[model samples]
Target: MAGNSDPLTPRAKLAVTAGKAVAAASRAAGRGSGSVIGGRVALKLDPDLLARLAQNLDVVLVSATNGKTTTTRLIAEALRAAGPVVSNALGANMPAGITSALAGSSEARYGVIEVDEKYLAGVARDTDPKCIALLNLSRDQLDRAAETRMLAENWREGLAGSKAVIVANADDPLVVWAASSSPNVIWVAAGQMWKDDAWSCPSCGGVMQRPGDDWFCGECGFRRPTPSWALSGDHVLDPHGSAWPIHLQLPGRANKANAASSAAVAAVFGVPPQVALERMYQVQAVAGRYDVVQFEGRDLRLLLAKNPAGWLETFSLIDPPPTPVILSVNARGADGTDTSWLWDVDYTRLTGHPICVIGDRKLDLAVRLEVANQQFQVCENLDQAVQLCPPGRIEVIANYTAFQDLRRRVGN
Candidate 1:
């Protein structure tokens, strides 16, 4: 909560200048937006660059296993109702990228940052945010972060005694445990369709019993707290018992849950829930997610699902039957070199679609589909997959790098 007038030290000022210069040079070289490399240089010059850059701005840090980018974008858009907001809109959620983003926009009154799940605690500590949104935590990147419970514990410890208002999901046990340490919290009953990671209680290591919509640890007293905000179908039911209809350009119940979390955070900054929601409806897509592009007289809708939990959500948004579906995956660094997570996803849901597989890990995906008794065509790339389909709309579901590759090729 440092004010905007708080001047940066001489070293910090120099670091910011040098970082911006490197970013510009990187852009000229077409090495992608220089956010990460430039941020590294800045942090190297001044180790405290992120904290210094966050001074005087009302920061809102958003973290989740899924929907981090989309939720961050929604939060930023809702905050625009108050004043100018700056964000790392292109999925750069690490400390260095965050430093570069804040350093680049000094005039903005607010900062909305999407944080990688594993790095959320560090980012939260440095930013000292006005509000923090914990959407959900599930199994993601087994190679990198295998312990989801450890992540929840880190969140609980990192946010202990923080003054920020916590906007968290009441439906997810991992999120509930993580945000429970905070003194102030606004709980939202955002639906959790994938509950594989939260069966064991994080606090007591006991089995959680879900008799109905309520979940409680039988051994320990830890349970789902009564939600102040709840989602019923397409509406967001607030604490005041007023149900507001959520009409978002982004499809699925997942995006609606994200909007509910965003509206709750915006309320802490004096923006009304209705006003915040009104602003959020304008966000049709986050980066390339849900972006529809035309290629070779066919429409392709791009969806990014990096893990099993994410895949479950994306499956609900895809077009029903007869619609050709393209499944792509990669074992790249960004996509978590392990493709074993594919088995956890229910490929049986894609029963009627003419499914085509592509990417470096297409063979793995094909084998999984085959195990499910689902027929699929293995293709070399997206263009070949699209060629297999008739002239019409094609649904594309890909992991991190595969989605990015399709987006670039399709000019999205």
Candidate 2:
């Protein structure tokens, strides 16, 4: 049981109460937690309570800078296909949110969760999951996460005491090297040519060379065997548009990588790879994470842009560009108070293109676009921006809070 004096417990209780209150209010108002405000409150409070509840179940925790939500959802879906699975389907990766999710579920054989990197150590201490999936780590939320090296070190220490089977990303030097000492590790690799970042070894500060489709160190010679599961060749047939035949509703290489990771983890739990892949094709994009909606005769595509890698990958998927994009930015405390990470995004890719900027931080986004030598029309508000977007097809890149605001405004 959590110590009473632990500050987290009281805060957890308050959060849980607030969540229930909000749910009640939404119901009374004839709405649902899918509402903008309801979703925000739910995301904030659920994790803490979920962490507390996770103590009762056999948990599988998944954590990474990218792909955590998609992988978690995929694993949960596959596990359900096999049997019963309890999971936080809304991308609640923190301990409390996970606990809340578990609390809402009935007794189940598996508790599969997507955990946040910052809170993984604490959650692991409380729940002691049966399996831990450590996906790739990259530079994200620099203001909060510090550095990749620091996060890797923290994860190593946190996972040191865990007895759970470790599932790692073999191509990511950070994940592979960090989990090298763990005896029960399952490594998954996604083709050699697909390696985008993390050029050097995280251990011994050595140069990492690609031995095959996987990575290895020339100095330390810490090489990983080929992944028990791998995704080869060109899985992404459509790089420029969202209408890909892969059957995944989300676009880009990142989604494909996420699908591959989820399949691998599911395979380890007695779910066949073919069955997992079949279910993966049925995977729908989570709300606000590349979900396309019909709005007033216009197709509005919403892609979440919380970090640089995510933003870059999203842009890569929309090649040739949407005629006029409604780019919204918000630096609300809940959506990450710091906005410096915006500089890290490759806005230069939009050079010579025109877009419509909207939201509380519209001027800031316009400034960014101007700095990148791109053209954009700044809208005073989201409604005007939505109204101005061409009718046939439109794209929207929004931060967390701005996404909800836009969704509500567009009636999605």
Each model's C-alpha lDDT?
0.91, 0.69
Per-residue CA lDDT of model 1 for 249-268, tens digit only, reads 99998999998888788889
1-412 in candidate 2: lDDT tens per residue?
A: 1233333466665765566576568768866442334334644764445445555566788998777887888778777777778887777565445655665555566788888888887777777777788887777655567688778888887888568778787777778766765677877664322244567667777877875455677897777665665554334221122222234666777777777677667766777666776677667777557678887777878878777766777777764654567788887765676777777777877664458898778877778787887878898886676677767667788887898888787777
Question: By TM-score, how accurate is candidate 1?
Answer: 0.98
List the candidates' TM-scores in order: 0.98, 0.81
Q: Which one is best on TM-score? A: 1
